[model samples]
Target chain A: MSSRVEILNDGGYRSDGRRQYELRDIDIDLSQQGTADGCCTITHGLTQVLVTVFGPKEAKMRSQTLHDRAVINVEMNVLPFSTGERRRRARADRRILELAATIKSTFEPVVQTTLYPRSQIDIFVQVLQQDGGLLHACINATTLALISAGIPMTDFVCAVSGGVHSTSPLLDLTTLEENDLPHMTVAVMPRTGKVTLVALETRLHVDRFADIFRLAGDAGQALHKEMKRAVKSRATRLVGAMETGMKPPMGGADAFERDVVMEDKMSF
Target chain B: MISFASFPVPSQNETQGMTRHHPDVEDDIDMDEGFEEGFHRLTSPGEPLTSSQAFMRGHGTYIDNDEVISSVAGTVERVNKLISVRAVRSRYNPEVGDLVVGRITEVQPRRWKVDANSRQDAVLMLSSVNLPGGVQRRKLESDELQMRTFFEEGDLLVAEVQAFFADGAMSLHTRSLRYGKLRNGQLVTVPPALIRRLKSHFLSLPCGVDLILGLNGYIWASKHVKQSEQEGEEAFDAEAVYSNKNDDIDDATRLAISRVSNIIRILAAHFIPLTDTLLLDAYEWAVEQEGDVKDLLQADIGDAMIATIAARD
Candidate 1:
């Protein structure tokens, strides 16, 4: 109703003070929450999503059990207060169910389900807050949670939202920008640079689609770098804790040299 | 209450520097120094570990285009010609004869589905359990009708992984008297990886607590049951074994059991490998503090407890 708010200002800066291609700050927390096998809380600026993965365990419903491989069940909940308006959405809301279905399909091929036969993998995605990019955050957090749960996945999936504001394409659209622009979310597998998901809800000019898609893909790769670092850092701490007694037979000098190299690379 | 401190701001570079340097200082003189070196050698999912021809792919790994790539984000382990990556946290992968404590989720014909905190519910067949009359008694159709009388839904029991079914679901057997309905205790779960294998999974502490360390990370701490008492009624105690009764546990025994369970919970929260010695050391340290059992969960007290346990090593 209010068309006075500016998404992209005349100065080439977005309303959130980010440049056209700049992404929002990403924060991830993989600490344990309850008895979930693995769980992660991820934030993309104002959007926050917590995903917990349980199983490759027994399926509660025998009818849903797959004989040749594992079954994936994804359930998503958007809190009433997650959006600007405090609106309560039903569990079977069409939009919410579609979102959950899209996420399940995105991860189906990536997860090596055949490795686990006659079991089920449950992914519970909770959207605590949202500005934009809800699907992107959910998909990304699910990927990390699955890895934490030790379910084998072919690769890490990184996602980002991109939109075209008039002629200038924007990366990581916020809710305000999303309302006024034609936006799409893209999820990419960093290892193979394969696009796992490309979700476009708004219609844009045919010529503009290729540009936004390529930009989202490139942004996905950048997101992948940050996500990979967080996962590897946590893995290092845990693996170190498990291997305390077996000090490298060589002197501390060799190990220190290796750490220095790691440090140098990490400095970037 | 949601705290802001829980969400550390978006300083990736600064946080990375801090994390790396903090471990750098601790690795040199820490008892767990070897772990730090190993951590650096860990692999992320999809990272090529080696050629498929040279290394056989194991769990947490897959053969992709003639290259063995990691399928989980964790440390790569090589045994003989087989290579695998072990995720830091995961569901318990049960092996034959491993001890486990599970809660019955459902009761079906001749079989009870037990949630063992694994990838699937482990199967506990009617024949796998000893009937109240005798171990040698035949499992008649009448026994099938009274399956709920044996191990009903929501009943927790201790059993061993009998074998694997055609589908990979583990079949558990509770035929042994020692492996039967669990009572007089509470279950505490931790990450499965933290429970290292020991010669004896059952431990009776001098503090009047009995500990059953299930490899599935389902630990049971209960009031100590004397071995002599067990032997005296060894025969014809099938009724007691199948009984859903909790013998009157005195206040003192209950307190001791709770204290030991709390200690295990604390140890698990810190990701410390739980061994009998470690638990013994932690129990002694907790008693020395002379504080309330609940105080052990406080952050400062928990830190001090971890420090005292580490100091002992």
Candidate 2:
């Protein structure tokens, strides 16, 4: 490769100092945003995305209503400052529309739309920052937002990006590595081990696909643990508040300790 | 072969933990034991609850491979052989014989579509309403043409869910004199879960203000109407009931209505369940503070009010 930055060093560390197959740290915030029914903001290292779910309510347009199930509408907006170079994109940008359509199809089979016939569920996704794995973060954030909104879903969809740097398979790649390597994003429903989405933008050797695919699946399970922990804690705090009639402490100390233990268990 | 070093294998303890939480497995230890009343068994989507052979699935749950799994992130509730999960935050789920405040969204030929904060716009049929001439009078064809005269677009009214259509849309009725157009009030919306059912949804305070707590999370606070002026079927004045003009609301009553509305808003922001007793106590607390009605919305003041209420409880 003619790039000045090294994708992988002699010691097996990447440019960001993460070893092969190491995932970026994830931070999730599940807080009420404005009047949305459910909202979530997730950060995968420097990449950040906020998702808000509005309905299961009446459809705005009569033509969009489905007689047997709810219609899912996804709208995505990438802020002009999200990328390294400052640029403005139109509301109907071709790339953004395609991304929104991809997300809508990914969730269609998972959400239990039949429960609310003749209704609509609006999912608004805002991309705050972009590093790499933008699609992965959007999918994960949307899942959390839908859960928080109390929408019925068969399972949680966890996603991660993987790439083959030369012959070594890397998990959760950054923009630098993504530019130099052949990468793909994979979303999995952890419980049933169903692959909901597999998006590949760059070409890769057929032989290398299986290895990266399996690695991404395993990484999704790890990410599932992180998301589950966040959902459980938020649920517990809300239940506690409702029961005791007081504001529950922010992420109780015991909960934080348990998270640490879980993290230790995850690191093989 | 390249070794997959980063991923952790599902350990024995983790697998056991899953089975241990299942209701059927827990049943074996104590046949007579059940979840404590008000105890919340929090669960997330796809978390298996019990074997379908031993329990029946309820709302927020689905049967998959002979197992009952939750489909939302909420508390697990059990009633005898039925298991269900109640989602913490969702759109209002309507039931029969419940009071709701709604705004007219569309005036159809014979029905007025209402925004009841539910999954679909509730239908209010012309036949379900009290005719202007009399309670039992037949509806004339001319009435259908002037539906807007009674409930034009954007008019707010309080009604009860009378029935449901085959498509799950709730039908509302305003046949009773108590249920009709709302005026001289402000509407405040909150999560439906915060409003609970009570003996009477219509509440009056000593401060010359009245409140209608719609189970659909639509709260209306308005000036108190004297019981004597609230006409019965004998003296039903259709002109007054469907009047577009608001009565003369004095500055004192107006201030009290705003104060009570603010209190309700603050309590809802704190996620506290609203009840008649709670509202009365909150109103008294606000008056004792002697601050402007707008001050109750201040973050610190709201926190103080919640803390005060919690301590008293």
Candidate 3:
């Protein structure tokens, strides 16, 4: 084995010091981004992705509209500096297109697109930083963005990546671990424990597949808890804001300033 | 299964009191009860709201298995036995008779497509608009060729939702004098939820600015036109109404317009619903600060303005 660093240490900790079943720390920001109906910036460890959702509004292209349902158009852009290599990928890059396609398909069954006919829901995913688990971050962020935008969906789709390092399975593998291990990303709708997507690029033993899949699904449930809390708090804050002066000013100025600063940062 | 009967219902007198106040006050009371009974409980997608057998699902909800699962992240509301979730943020859902400000996107054969921030671009049929000479003028073939003169693509106008087509697309009409061709104005977009239906959607401020509060969240702030100069049905001047030229605006009026627009933008950023009283107070606060119109956008000043307004309320 040409692996310079040990994937798992003697203490049963991975290179990032996480245990076999431990996932990366997740950070979610479901704030308004310009005119987007819903927007979310999610970070999993060092991987960061920003997803903005616009519409269920008029379809820009008449041909793309469906007579009985809304069409979802997913456009993804991976910033050249997102990865250590700093390579610029063309808009039509096959891998990027494939990832976008994967995201669109994953959300198709979850979002109740039938509610709005002859309209289009645009999901714009921007990969800000990438260490690993890029797909997981994108899918999770898109889910939150859709929810915040008030797009109806059957359930929240929580995604997490799992890998098999030798016989042991590791959750939320970093770039280094992902490069050297057989990993797969799983997206699950937490309500019914239904698996929406299972994307595997590397080969893994048949027996190991079931274990990682189940582990990823459980991790997705944990992710659902975090996402649900964020959405609930956001809804509560918005409802409170809409209630006008009925309640005392609760973080009104502070929150407004934060939003202004965030908008300024996004402009760059 | 949780029984909703145990929740305290508002008495008849309370409802009467609600009617006596502003219509929006009734909404506030309803929300308060929603909070108390947990009927307006915050729910996320996939959350099981209630048994399908007990309730009929409405918008933002779908029946899955035997339960009515919420399809959106919002507060779950129940009207009698029909349960629905009103999304906190979404595209404008237009209703009949709503005044909206829209920009023309396309001029079709007999209808003009308008970007009204709704699910679909609202259609403004030729028959729904007033002609140049008079209100009751017959449709002429020459007018068909000169549609661009009336409302070319990209012209902003104020209109009312006349009706809806079978596909849920709203049809708009600009037959009223106050409804056509916006000029000497600025359009500021905000979330539709922030605009409450008031006694009147039109307001003329003391600062020489007229405001049109579009229910679709499009606000038009322009130079106030005097009532005497406004054309009536008998003197409908199509040339002036459809004219692309902007009236010469003096510097002070321009300053006031920007200040009003900026104030509206700031209030919207804070997610505060725009009421004439609240806006008047905010404007007064802005004028007292005496900051530059651009400076009103600054974080500190904007925060102070919102703080002052909230305190006053």
In candidate 2, residue A127 scores what lDDT?
Answer: 96
lDDT of 2: 0.86
lDDT of 2 by residue, B163-243 (tens): 999989999999998899999888988789887775567766678787888999999998888776787679889889999
The local distance difference test score of each candidate is: 0.82, 0.86, 0.85
iRMSD (Å), candidate 2: 17.9
Give the TM-score (vs. native) of candidate 2. 0.89
TM-score for each candidate, following the candidate numbering: 0.88, 0.89, 0.90
Clashes of 1: 5
The candidate that achieves the highest DockQ relative to the unseen native structure: 3
How would the docking of model 2 be graded? incorrect
How much of the real interface does each model capture, measured as fnat?
Answer: 0.50, 0.44, 0.56
Candidates 1 onward: DockQ, in order: 0.27, 0.23, 0.28
Q: Give RMSD (Å) of candidate 3 vs. truth.
A: 11.1
Better of 1 and 2 by DockQ: 1
Q: Deviation in angstroms for B55 in model 3?
A: 1.3
Off by over 4 Å in 3: A245-268, B1-39
**Candidate 2 DockQ, CA atoms:** 0.23
